[model samples]
Target: GFAGNTIPIVAGSALLALRALEEDTKANGKITITRGDNPWVDKIYTLMDKVDEFIPTPERDTDKSFLMAIEDVFSITGRGTVATGRVERGSVKVGETIELVGLGNTRTTTVTGLEMFQKTLDESVAGDNVGVLLRGVQKTDIERGMVIAKPGTITPHTKFESQVYVLKKEEGGRHTPFFCGYQPQFYVRTT
Candidate 1:
């Protein structure tokens, strides 16, 4: 739940950091960074009696097929394009054909490399934050919410409807029902 709130906010903010792997030979990688710079965070936590709780790692949703949410995308000057995010499920290896699906953009490319914490990896599974180098797609080809997965594993949709409950002011939620043309935020994995 912490990651659910943190990743999307940082993704939209200007604080997303893009780094090159030198010791880890990073072609590209994106990491979620939450700075406790908020003046209210301490008070909020102290009021809840959980002052020691920092950023909580999301529980890894281990599965059988490869899935990774695109947290960041950038290009290395001489090598190739890199996508970085935590693997949500399954595993992917170098040279495996993967599909980028989201935001009405679907493209196929081969995974040329994966690097995490500056070290190269042969494969990345759920819970590992890694940067994946691609063979064909350019940095401009993908977006933050697009997912990298085994080809045919996902289908992209342009629109979908979800049910949301409007809470009362007594419950610390909005007191009024949404008016016409109200748009709510949707947080799906990293995107």
Candidate 2:
């Protein structure tokens, strides 16, 4: 369930979650559901083969290709810059070189370290939220809405086409009509 104002966004996220669970179950032959006090806990538990017992391992591709959606950026005392985000595809490891793509430019940088929940990790795979310290890049060079990816794997683009639903018009009386060339601040991932 979602709040009143976030129904559409939550629905899309729920759909994706269900799809991922289905894929995991099919690949692993079993699924585990953690019990909680939430109303839907029992419903989810009933759909699984085990409760708090089965651990599904996700396959990680470490073929030198990866992508991360930047959620936050900060600077450390000794480290140059750090970007935190979930790995969207492939895997990244310490010492690997990557390209930062955003803000109408691309900069190449190396991964100096990786951390999650205040603990350092040698690598991070898809679906793992982690912070990566980067070398040769300043904090001002990165920002939210940027993407970090393996060098030569992605090309940054300024124009994109997407379908948007106008909620105001669907609620009740007519609002200001939107026309072509209308621009709005778009939020993606955690940005």
Candidate 3:
């Protein structure tokens, strides 16, 4: 437990840290980043209002069937390979059958174990980040961006139609139109 050091720094310190992280990230990879000024700097109340307007409280659908996006995979000695990721929907428990779907393959596997933060769990629900030990799959076969989901729940595709929103120039965004094959970067847990 991180006790005193575990807590997060906020406001100015957090903003400064974001800038520092941008530089560190660029050095680690052949990527470019830009850290812009916070229009709400020193304006906590206004920022809070904007946050409330834009983002709402998260609602986890534990009642749905199991779903987890595979963020990583690794093998344990004698225990089989593990697919690790957050439960985007529903819940999963030990000994249940699951399907690994996405990235050009689909396979059925049993959940031999479930773990989080070095602790073994009987079940993990929506919003719970977990690592699932699986039987009959190789760590080399499963890749990131795949889903460990309930059987017949997910449909994988190489392309699909989607709606997009482009920000205006005033909000530090360009009003640029996208052309064919204009791929954009996405972060972790993108559905």
Candidate 4:
């Protein structure tokens, strides 16, 4: 029962922390993050009517934007096609098929399921959640986050243009009002 005691304690702590975080997020709309930023969490900012965007500076300045490599692909029996991880721009919708482009190759698949934030939806657009599924293609062909899109819609590019912005901070270690024309890292999604 040693593991049980410790596990429940940890679980309870996590639940409480999550509750507090949800409350804080509701009241403030956004949390000032310091490390390990999940672009999805910030996606809410874009989804919500609150503000425009959150920009992060890249480690180095270069014309080529980073591409998420495909990790793995899955083919569920009778469930259709689905891809996991490496989410780029836009959203993946259930029953809506998209093209998988990368590695000097491209293919098409229909979305069967879109899972994000412990919630499953019929479709997922940009900033929806995470785990996306499609209809066509096989497990051997696709990989994780392989930049799914509509055929002929997008092409693999080493370089792209993006607009970056950051929240204005006040003098007392607080966020100031938002403004336009601010320069910051541009967090972009490719699909």
Give the range where candidate 2 is weakest over 10 consecutive residues by summed lDDT. 6-15
lDDT comparing candidate 3 with the true structure: 0.79
Tally clashes: model 4. Answer: 19
Q: What's model 1's lDDT at 162? A: 75
Task: Check candidate 2 and list the clashing pairs.
Answer: none
For model 1, how does the per-residue alpha-carbon lDDT over 1-191 read when each residue is reduced to its tens digit? 45665332211211212221131234334322223533233334343343234546566666678999999999998888999998989989988999998877688889999999999999888989999999978888886888998898889887897777777899899877788999787868874
Task: Write one digit per residue (lDDT tens) for candidate 2, span 65-136.
Answer: 799999999999877789999898889889999999978689888999999999999989888889999998
Can you give the TM-score per candidate against the true fold? 0.64, 0.64, 0.60, 0.41
Could you tell me how far off, in angstroms, the CA of residue 185 lies in candidate 4 after the best superposition? 24
lDDT: worst 10-residue window of model 3: 31-40
Better of 2 and 3 by TM-score: 2
Q: lDDT values of the candidates?
A: 0.76, 0.79, 0.79, 0.53
**Candidate 3: which stretches are off by over 4 Å?**
1-59, 166-191
Considering TM-score, which of the candidate structures 1 and 4 is the better prediction for this target?
Answer: 1
Backbone clash total for model 3 is 0
At residue 66, give the lDDT of candidate 2: 96
User: Over 4 Å off in model 4, which ranges?
Assistant: 1-71, 75-80, 157-191
